[model samples]
Target: MFRTFVSGLILLLPLIITLAVVAWLGQFIIDYVGPSSIVGHALTTIGFSFSASQIVAYVIGLIVFLAVVYLLGLAVESRLRSHLSQFLDSTMRRIPVIGNLYDLIQRFVALMDKNDVEGLKSMSPVWCFFGGLDGAATLALLPTPEPIMVGDKAYHAVLVPSAPLPVGGCLIYVPAEWVQQADVGVDKLVSIYVSMGVTSPLKIPPLPGPGPRKGNLTAT
Candidate 1:
């Protein structure tokens, strides 16, 4: 009987945990969108016009949340998005320490958003040699196609993300020859970083020559 009970309990664990999660989510929704809360009351009021049931009011609140998000996505394509984004950035930047964190998080999120074709596509994975071709080779990301000017010399913007959380990193401006664009996709590179070097390319070609060390990179 003890053995049977243990087996039954083990079998039910998954279902129990799943139910617990669903219950927690439902409570969270009620706490945030229930009639007692400010936003909840507003949503409930909007929902009441369509249905008398309070349950329906909560459902309508979620619908409103999704609708607002959809509208915001559409707004991204409009000219007003620039002004709105600038205003938002300026407002957040006024908060001192947290403001800088917010800005970093925003850029990191933009870099990770694969659906954002223009923003995310511009950043490509590359390998950077710290002191030049002879220095240590580090897998990094190039945020732009063109090189940025550092005095008279041109430098490629290299973002070397830390292991595990690619959220925080140092941006290095390296000379053209120091940066060699990686053949791997952003997703693959991110996986390798997130896995702490556990996941890696099966084979990577050896670093090429100390050919043209001067001037911008010419098309090969």
Candidate 2:
């Protein structure tokens, strides 16, 4: 009976833990800056009370954060963002431990925002093809170039990411011809990768081939 209970818990633990953490964070924020009784009393005498307006501040903060993000996205395209990011990065790099953490976070955010077609084009799937059949493989993009000289044949570099997670991986430079485009959208490919290949898009069946006519010979 204990073993069975443990097995069931193991199955549902991740989802339960996720919800618990979300709830805790929400409550923590709400309690930390929520209106106090004194503020509530002052507002109440002045036509508002903490009990009546406690949620207003939290709601405003959330709205402001979202609005800022939306406005930044509208105003700044990749080129602009890249320039701004470089400036910020340079400033951050001057700091100590914070600089390293900032750079790591910046790289993560850049990878996550690869929805732009130009950015998406740089990322290609690393296929493991054999005899006209291609199965499990990884996708990657070239964020930086590395110069390589193999027996006097010099070449640039490419970054190859492991499957399921692009951020955790290495960089290697294969010949340009070897890296072929998968022609898949970055969003869809990310979904497939995150789900570990379970979430594939629906395939369309080919049109039927021409078949010999059976009836209607009388008209001919």
Candidate 3:
């Protein structure tokens, strides 16, 4: 009896979550278009002064917002606007702490944008071993090919994401030989990480490089 109840709950959980999300979104729209909201007041000023229905207000406001966003996207694609955007971006990056935060956020957003053809598609998934410890390997993304040169030696820059939340983690430069490509897609790796290894592969693949190095894998 207990087993049956558990199974039933598992089956219905997704549906329940979906409905809850829909309900919350509906309530949010209603509130956003309520009498006291900025959109509501704007609508009144634009000769929609007689419409008291929240639904009507919500539909109109949502349409207006979407249209504005669409137009802005089109404007950004224009050559003049594109150059202006680049200039603005460069100006923002000249700031102190805010510049650093902006860079981090930009990288994270680019990583999450699947539709971005030239974004993270360039990143390679890899299993990185620090100190040559086979058991202490971390899944990471190699975002660039340019190696960090130290005198004659070159080290690869890698980002090791925190499980369940890839946005937060360490950025380390390691020898290219210490990092081997992981046999998994970016989206799949994200799922496994977010699941805390629960959805991990049954068997991990071997590292791509040749035989192991004789000495420990040092960062320098």
Candidate 1 — worst ten consecutive residues by lDDT sum? 211-220
Rank candidates, TM-score, best first. 3, 1, 2
Error of 3 at 62 (Å): 15
Quote model 2's TM-score. 0.39
lDDT of 1 by residue, 123-149 (tens): 777888878777888888776657767
- By lDDT, the candidates rank as 1, 3, 2
Q: Which pairs of residues have clashing backbones in candidate 3?
A: none
Cα distance off (Å), candidate 2, residue 155:
5.4
Q: Best lDDT goes to which candidate? A: 1
TM-score of each: 0.51, 0.39, 0.54
Write model 2 residue lDDT over 10-117, tens digit each, in one string.
Answer: 999989977986797677655654445453333334432222453564455445556888888865765587677568779998899999777655654455675544
Q: Deviation in angstroms for 78 in model 3?
A: 10
Provide the clashing-pair count of each candidate structure. 0, 3, 0
Query: Higher lDDT: candidate 1 or 3?
Result: 1
* Tens digit of per-residue lDDT, candidate 3, span 25-82: 6777768775467866675444344356755755666567678878878887676665
